[model samples]
Target chain A: MGFLGYRRPDGSVGIRNYVAVMSSVSCANGVVNALSREMTEIKPIIHTEGCGRGLADIAISTRTLAGLGKNPNVAAILIVGLGCEFIKAPGLADQIKPSQKPVEFLVIQENGGTVKTTRKAIEICGKFLDYADSIKRTDCGWDKLTLGLECGGSDALSGVTANPVIGVAADWLAAQGGTVILAETTEMIGTENILARRAADPAMGEKIKSLIRKQEKLTKDILGPLAGLVISPGNIEGGLSTIQEKALGCIIKAGNSRINELVEYSAAPSKKGLVIMDSPGSDIFQLTGMAASGAQLTLFSTGRGTPAGFPIMPVLKISSNTELFRKMEDDLDLDAGQVLAGKSIEAVGKELVSLMEEVVNGKQTKAEINRQDLLAIHTVGPAF
Target chain B: MQEQINAVLIHPSDNVAVAIREIQPGEAILGLKQKISARQNIPRNHKVALVEISIGAKIIKYGETIGIAIQGIEPGDWVHTHNLKAEEI
Candidate 1:
């Protein structure tokens, strides 16, 4: 069954409708947090990388922050900033103006101080919440949904059970005209050829190859003797013997769908079906990038268990093994480990899809219940 | 007749299977058409060679080459970092 979602003026769909307060630079995070603490209706977007960075990181930060503001999940947004920071609140708010949502900006230095800026933010955000609350959820089709695929803290069962189960659902969603995003270029190592071959066209296939190739080389150059050459003793001890084996586990979450688009970090998909966003393998950065790309929800599987959720999007956690599922029952959403118990992959996938429906239809996941609102932006280069 | 499954064949084209539970030496490696007994103590979640693989052959799992076998691998041989080498970038 389809779910009820908030439709944006730009025709995008959102599973959640929240009034958000974001810090344009790290200096304003204190005020942003204070506003959220004072107003329970505001989802706070806090981060550490708004300034004191090279141009590359600034570009990434600006794009990511704008993407998060423009994300359909936020019905309204308030940007807070320090006047002297590289990424100012007005500039960031201007980038998100195309969304046609209620937007406001505050400068801590100009607004008197943290206390004064936060007071004004609370007033503006309170009005935004009122506007947000007036909107109602409408029926949305699968075509309006974009689900992101992610996996972290993995064990061997991640590939055999959780990721493959996610794959089946990913392919099913794509077949139904919904969008699925596969990210984390760091985990796409050694399987560049395999993934590229599934691209929508030869040119996109080449792009996929080069994107993964660049990540592989960077991994080697930066993590020499630590990555790319051999499985670490730690990895071997944990039962994985090769980089491909580890990487294969991650890529399976995309299923067999043809990758229709490849977007840069935090860029929105221009097509449906499966898309790959270039992001770090680090869990928080990938989650935030996918969220900023306008994914309404995420399908995150873990073998070792991670309680990571985005500020606005819902994260449905699936466990790779039955034991971990039992151990982390309160934290996980689905149990794919039944595949090892003789259940077929398709069966668990269907179950996962059903669970996904419930979550999208306003069911609170464990992460949401625990208020696991984590956010981070991927920085491509050194600071200062 | 049904056989007890102790390992999982991730893909039909795969030449190796991952043991769902530890397999003792001489125990039959399930999930393969040809009966292959574990040659040594195969750790849980570790790969077992379903077919005898000569050295330098591509090690297949999920129906793709994950790496290359550095040493000749017998059926039910435990594949790890020592014998399985990662593919070069």
Candidate 2:
């Protein structure tokens, strides 16, 4: 099957063509927001990771900034920075230069101040919008798609219906030669052995094991004793008792596909199929990593429901129960609750894939229409 | 879709069932041949013991060990943090 998408010069396909205005550091956020406000077509990537961070955090921030700019969904990028930030505007733009897309750099410190930089950004972004508008959607094969699989606000039905249903769709896309990224390393606590067992080889399996172990140790060091829960209190109220129960449900979103490789946060996949990314389980943070890793779209399963989306990509929200679906009708895109009411997973999976086709064809999701674009970078170390 | 469903046994091997609807005390859950009645008010999405569980026995839900019973749990008992604790992996 094929969907309408924007074909990038780097051979990547995008379902959205956005002119991105990104802040290299928190200091330039106001300018980035102001410029994006003037242009409705401009997507603002305002984040808080330009300075006062450890080396690990700086590296993560740099990679995340470069990846988002390089994402095929962004037709043009305008990076704004404060001249003295650790991550410079030019350095950030240079990282995305390989994408060969239109990239402009403006510094608030160098270009006078906020007002001048905003003016410069407005003029620059206007040009980007012109370039972005010229890009047309072309027919692209399903093979060009890279999907992000995610779950949040999980209930008991999440494991049985929503996650398993998304899993079925994930398997379908993988069979079509598409890439699927399974993130939230903390959610893989109990199910690491199960997932590792499905790895391509013994070494890959060991990598999966170590990733989970590392995540567990980090959480323990940060949160003290209750770190075993890994999940939030909301998850417990949703019927998940422990991390193991949540992990069992979480891993089902990957389907039964063989894991190809394990990647670091914001790192793009090396090959197509199922790839596990090391990232925290926070909904927005995970979405950021997935989007930066080149996922064209994200399929988010929820039982309690959430209205989170990315600036450039559409987040397809699926709910497992009819009550939550009715309650969050304005936010959710599809209902896999039918599986719990007796429909087959294959049927819901087919419906999900069909919905994906419509979304790629320019059908805006509830998150997109509502403009719930929340972006956050996953930083590991403390700021110093 | 069947309306007003009260509970769902996720897996055949699972020793607990999730309450799809709030199951009142003494309500007979369907699909179980033994005709077990809820011993107490079981909230929706919460677990109900399908079989008697001894102290320190694994509280199996989703066919996986979610926690272990800290006390003897009778069939139809509402299973939660009060009598169960998260298992160490």
Candidate 3:
């Protein structure tokens, strides 16, 4: 069955026809945020990057911002930049122009300051919103959909319940020809060989192995045997002493599918099947990376409960245990804890897919309803 | 009365099982041969060696080697950071 979606000029399918305003640099965040306040209809994406950084960070920020602007969920985008910044607003607008969407830019310095930029950006967004509203939604196939696989705040039940359920749903989407992205390099430390074996070709397998091995070496220096970001007193108490055991829980959400293509952080995948985006294990960074890569929606599972949602797309939260689901009833969307109560993963997965279909059909998830709009870009280097 | 399970063996080839709930010292691990009893207090969600493992042997869980035994481990002994060391690929 197809869901209603907006067909963009560049032939991309968008589940949400949102007009977005983003800051090209941290200095212009005030103007971008002002634009959002002036026109609440426009989604504002504010980040702390874009200026005074090394070449690697500049490239990463530029690529990530451009990617976010080109995402199919965004009908049009307005970039606000401090003129002196390394990553320019015009550059970001130019990069996103190929998407055939209405892309605009306002330099805070050139536009007389934050006040003028905010006023001008508001007017631009007003027109974009009107144009976005005029667009019509048509039935789009699942093949046009790309789903990001994410899990955080995990408990022991996460691997056995919610993750496995998410895995089944991921497999279902893959079978329907939809794209699924499995990120979180830090979580795949021990499973490098296993993931490598699942790759579609020898070269892809080697790439997968190398990517995970690199993460293992990088994170191993920080906390000894523990993978970065996942080492907590809770994790230690839960019997996850090694990176492999911890990562094994996270990779299950990718489901049992042949690895198709592996892309750099925030880069779009060229293949159709299950792809992997090289992203950090941190929730917000990874979520933004997936959004920048054009995932209209993401499936997130949590044991302790994380309420974060992307500004441009929907994030569906699944709770591992029934207690947490009940506690976070207003925040979480589904409960996979029924597996502990004798319900099968297949059944929960089918329910999750149904919810996904409803979401794609315009139904809002808990994250969307709560407006948990959070965004953070992953960086390779620190800002100067 | 129904038998209650205390630990979970995630894979057939795994020599370690995770304690689903805390098992006291000398308590028999459920779902296994009655001969094996907990050698020490196995905390909830912690690993318990299901078989004898010599030092430097790879510790298996979920059918993959997660770490190596830094010290000799016996059946029902709690295996954690103290006894296991994570290896780099």
Candidate 4:
């Protein structure tokens, strides 16, 4: 199967053609937002990770910023900077220049001020948009696509229905020579053993376990002694008792496919069929990491219901609860709750794959159609 | 022979079954002995008591104890935040 998508200079296929205004540092977000606002064709890609970060943290932020420019969806990029941040705008622009896409830089300080920077950035973005618009869409094979699998706001049905259904779609995509990324490291807590069993090699299996351990350690260190307390409230309300139970259910979204590789958060996959990405369970952050890693689209499973979207990638929301689907029809795209009503999982899985095809062929998801809330926050150490 | 309603028991240790649908009051649920009541409008993904239990009894779902009963609950009663309280591990 093939869909009409923009062909990037790097030979990557982009389902959407957007001229992106990216902020090099948190301080320059306002300027980038203003610049995007002035240009009808320019879309602002904002995040909360560029400043006040240590070396490792700044590295992640810089890599993620550069990855956003590398995303196929972004035809051309304009980097806005405050001029003296850890993540330098010039460095980011240089990193993206190899993509053969237009990469421009504007420093708020060098440009004189916010108003002047915004004006200059807007003019640069206008030209970028014109260049972006000049690129025409061409039909591309399904193999050229990479999909991100995600789940949030989960409940019991999430495991039994939506996740597994989405899993089926993941396997289908992988079978078609397409790439699939399974993220949310925190959710794999108790079920890492099961996932590890599907690793392509023993080293990859150990890596899976290592990532889970690192995530648990980080959560404990960050949240302190009462770290586990947060799980109680959501689990109690949703009828989940233990972290193990949630993990088991959460792992179902990975399906039964062999995990081909393990990637760091926001790191692009070298070669992909099915890969595991280390990411937090936070919905927006995980989605952002997935997008930065070059996922063309994302499939999100929700049991209780969540309405999160991404600026560059289309997020397809699926719910396992029919009631939630009905109640949040405007936010959800598919209902796999029928698995609970005795519908076969295979049938629902097939349906999910078909729906994915429809989504790839220019169908707008509920999140994209409504222009729902989209935000990203990367976890990093203090800026030094 | 009739086919049993397909439902995941989660764990062998749990006594309650999660309602996959809006099981009305007095309706006999497949695969279990108890008939359920609307209780409090048990929406999809919500839990239902499989056996009558007094206050403080642990509520099990997904084969793990999710919360404890805050009040006496009858079989078929909906188990949610209102009637169940989360306990520290």
Task: Please give each candidate's TM-score.
Answer: 0.91, 0.84, 0.84, 0.80
Off by over 4 Å in 4: A224-245, B1-89
* lDDT (tens digit, per residue) of candidate 1 on A1-384: 577999898888888998999999888989988887899878999999889999989999999999999888899999999999999999999999999988899999999998889889878987898899898999989999999999989886898889989988898899989999999888887778888788889999899999988887888898895676545677677678877887777787988778899999889999999999999878999999998898889999999998888888899999999999999898999999887777767788999988888888889999999889999899878887
Reference-based TM-score, model 3: 0.84
Instruction: Give the per-residue lDDT digits (tens) of candidate 4, residues A188-238.
Output: 765556577789999888888888877777777887957744456756566
Model 1 chain A poorest 10 in a row by lDDT: A225-234
How far out, in Å, is residue A130 in model 4? 2.2
Docking class of 3: acceptable
lDDT by residue for model 2 (A1-384), tens: 588899888889989999898999998999888776777778899988989999989999899989999988999999999999999999999999999899989988889998898888888888888888899998898888889989988766888778877888898999999999999887787766667778999999999988888778877887896876567788788777777777877787877789998888988898899999998889999999999999989999998889889898899999988889999999999998876575556778899988988998899999999999899998877887
The TM-score, computed over Cα atoms with residue i paired to residue i, of candidate 1 is: 0.91
Off by over 4 Å in 2: A229-243, B1-89
Candidate 3: TM-score, chain B only: 0.92
Q: Compare candidates 2 and 3 on lDDT and give the better one.
A: 3
Question: Looking at model 3 chain A, which ten-residue stretch has the lowest summed lDDT?
Answer: A222-231
Q: For model 4 chain A, where is the 10-residue window of minimal lDDT?
A: A228-237
Candidate 2 per-residue lDDT over residues B26-85, each given as its tens digit:
899764546799999998888899999999999876555778999999999998888898
Residue B45, model 1: lDDT of 84
Model 3: per-residue Cα lDDT over A102-167, one tens digit each: 999998888899788787887888889889989999988999999998998977888867887898
State each model's CA lDDT, in order: 0.88, 0.86, 0.87, 0.78
True contacts kept of each: 0.46, 0.39, 0.43, 0.21
